[model samples]
Target: MTANEMTGGEALAHMLLAHEAGPIFGMGGFQLLPFYDAARRLGLQHHLINDERCGAFAADAYAKVTGRVGLCDATLGPGATNLVTALVESLNAGIPIVALVGNTHRLHSWKNMTQESRQVEILRPAVKEIIRIDHIERIPELIRRAFVVATTGRPGPVVVDIPEDIAHATYPFDETWFEVDSTYTAAPALRTRPAAENLAAAVELLVEAERPIMLCGGGVHISGAAQMITRFAEAINMPVAHTMSGKGSIACTSALNAGIFGRYDRIANRLIDESDVLLVVGCKLGEIATKRYTLPEPGKKIIHLDIVAEEIGRTVIPSVSLWSDAREGIADLLEVLPQDELKERLAKWAATVATRMQQWRVDVAPRLTSAEVPINMARLLHELNLNLP
Candidate 1:
């Protein structure tokens, strides 16, 4: 044991710091006061929102912006229940969040204790994992597991429900207890490269493709593959269309960026509709994005890349499934292609799409400026987002 015995609450704080998971967004309650004190003492910053809902939203946004696990903590009962909305949003979006929720004491479980409720069942539907710490000594390992489970693989929220008694209880501070296998966080997802045969086949499809398109989703950002995606797209001069969730991954100013996809964006939808071959990377190709599974021109060669193997085949079966992270999988395919092979044949095809887009913009130009009271909904958004960094 290298340090003095510490409260389980302190151990939670230390472990969160070690995993680089915090700047907790939450509110304190009676049962979790000990945890708040410990967190403050350990220099873990807390952004105390007035409401638990706000805290959840803040934490979710923090995770998206910082590209790390977002953390939210709250005491028992009402606080945990209040966090459900934020939890579901992240669950569907595939964002990573670690929720630290206080629970009633083990002894008080069946009894009508103050603000007692089943925290696990409530959090289960929303999170990938739900852990209950009955023993204070288990805090170190459980806390470590929470971060990894939340951030690894498909990446979703996790809930750690600590009983008040355990949080306030003391545990022997062994340095060994602090041991957490942090490989999931320290290393990028690109480490899980797809097999060589799969890579070669996917590359051949793209190389033979006369009109190819790259469909990026939030996973592109999650895998930190945005820059690589851009470089590869530019190398092949392939037009790219991304889901709204992946907007920031590529600069809108890029010539090949077709902008946000789905029903509302005609240019993006048209490019996908017109493609001879499609490379789907880090995207679910959900109903909203695919417009009820009608796009991609049915049976066109689809090369899909994703972290979850199950996700690869569930909806749209890929001609070549590179069941790997976006960065590594894309990097593999990029490697097989001849270097500096700009899309010479694709230049005219790209120009055709560009010409159509230009004409549409010209047609809509007056409608955007027609002195309407609402100030042209489309123009307002376009002007507002212009020059945005």
Candidate 2:
């Protein structure tokens, strides 16, 4: 292939390789042969899976594990449709993936094509964007845009359909088209810190409360603020309870760990009910986490910290809302706190929560033996606690 006369297939393969694409998972057919040949020439490793659906799933798994755009390919019609289920999963799970599908040639396009339908329209709803390439020259631009859309705000999948005629057509490789600016990074706006007066009011509530519990959520993991959470909890000696996804936000083995808070454990439910104050950090207070917002009595105070202000007071109205990065908010609160008083209160609360947890375990122990298989809640909790940090 001459430098200025590279085939569309070669250009597509080069662009994907430029992005450092690895082991593309997909099923192959005659329509996609040119693209596969190009990939082989470019030394881009191909992961040939048994079915197109599995290929899409493997691609989703790859993206989730590597934090990069996953790649999958399929031939026209049925092959493309087979990937729909896995593509939907990737979309819901917020994974970045690229689906490349082959299409009938331009000359044969409208003549009752055997393996051709409106592939782009069918996939439009399930992906970030869809680019149907009828011309060879548009391949580079389309590929670049696909990556941009797939990995951006609330990342999901994108689709690129290459007509067989276009794939075989020759075009000059445009190096500049694939060069993305290094400094362009996706950074969502962090939440702003609470005002001094608001902070003071929240602190007052915590200081006066006989039982105060700290609840952590997925945002802690997303913000990489687990250590900050641990620091804040330790500084106050407060009992730490995590939502299922936030299990590792604080070391589960820590003496201050009060176990998961939600419908999962009776002790957790009791702790939420009895606590005078709740410090909700990075948790959205979603229905799954709060059991449809069946919270404690109306008089209890709640201090909620989250990156998005709307998430605060979502399920239950919070007494104080700190719209800020969870890590930064916790750090700021620690700075302004009466450390001695907070520590004393935390120690007392931890002891109380721990005792309640032990009693809960004892109470649930009998329920396990009621069944022939035994519903081992304690064992499950133990296993979960062991797996968590």
Candidate 3:
């Protein structure tokens, strides 16, 4: 082997490092030993896991927190299968993750090879895409494609299957070939904005609405638009409600906060029912968010904004659909809003929300201090909240 030549495992590690993908999680096995060894030599961070499922979950959490494409790995058959549950979670939650799986040698596959089951078929439904690298020369390109698929447009997990033979094959290295597209390294890679006409239409509805609310979903957090959404809601004095996954889209202490709606929620459901116009951002208004698809009630005008256009009307049809990245859409809405006028018009509503929140706090106050035998969950939660640093 010459300096210009690199093994498939080395190519995979080099490309991942070039893309700054790190803190990988997985339990290594014989089929992936070369890749693991290359990862170690290349100083790529790897957190050893007892199970592949745990690694996938760790990756999911990492993506949720950092807005980056999380990376994980697995060996053949059972190891690959173990990632299904976590992959499905990432798919549904729209978190970006790139999973690398080892495979039996291509020559030995289906010849009664150990740990050889149709892994690709098993993982197809669990991920956005499953890519198998049949040729060693394509390792860098395929790995690059995996990241692109995982992080782009609605973000989800992508699996890159590397047969043992492919992992060990050698190919000439070209630094330029290993260079990664910077765009696909993180979630919401494109940050697309809605059309000017659509944004204008949404603004018109919000301006005209007598009782307007903003409902945020996990997309706010995923797009790193929490701060933008918070600022927009506060500026217009719009009462903001959220689904469970959108908990931190705004500060819990914000005066405009209406809390979570739907099952296992706070005081937002009633507000949603009464609102004349609902501005939903980043949320799909799924079953849990809509209380089995019944909240928001019929006859209410809705302005829906999201990265995925298809989801805009999948549940509750939006009167005005703004298809864009959460942050970009919120920024545009703020840009077009008649701030001074909106604040003045919404003052009464804001006051009402404040009053309602005060009464809610009062209603739940006793539960926070309850010292009953086993102790109420609310009281325990309050205690924990007070004690946590």
Which candidate's TM-score is highest? 3
Error of 2 at 18 (Å): 2.7
CA lDDT, every prediction? 0.81, 0.77, 0.90
lDDT of predicted model 1: 0.81
> In terms of lDDT, which candidate is strongest?
3
Total colliding residue pairs, candidate 3: 0
Clashing pairs in 1: none
lDDT tens digits by residue: candidate 3, 277-300: 999999999999999988878878
Per-residue alpha-carbon lDDT of model 2 for 259-307, expressed as tens digits?
Answer: 7777675567677887889999878777767876676557678998886
Select the stronger candidate by TM-score from 1 and 3: 3
Kindly indicate the candidate among 2 and 3 with the higher lDDT: 3
Which ranges of candidate 2 are over 4 A from the true structure? 1-4, 103-111, 128-138, 181-215, 275-286, 293-341, 366-389
Residue 283's lDDT in candidate 2: 82
- Mind sharing the TM-score for model 2? 0.73
Model 3: which residue pairs collide?
Answer: none
Give lDDT for model 3: 0.90
List candidate 1 segments past 4 Å from native.
181-190, 339-342, 385-389
The C-alpha TM-scores of every prediction are: 0.94, 0.73, 0.97
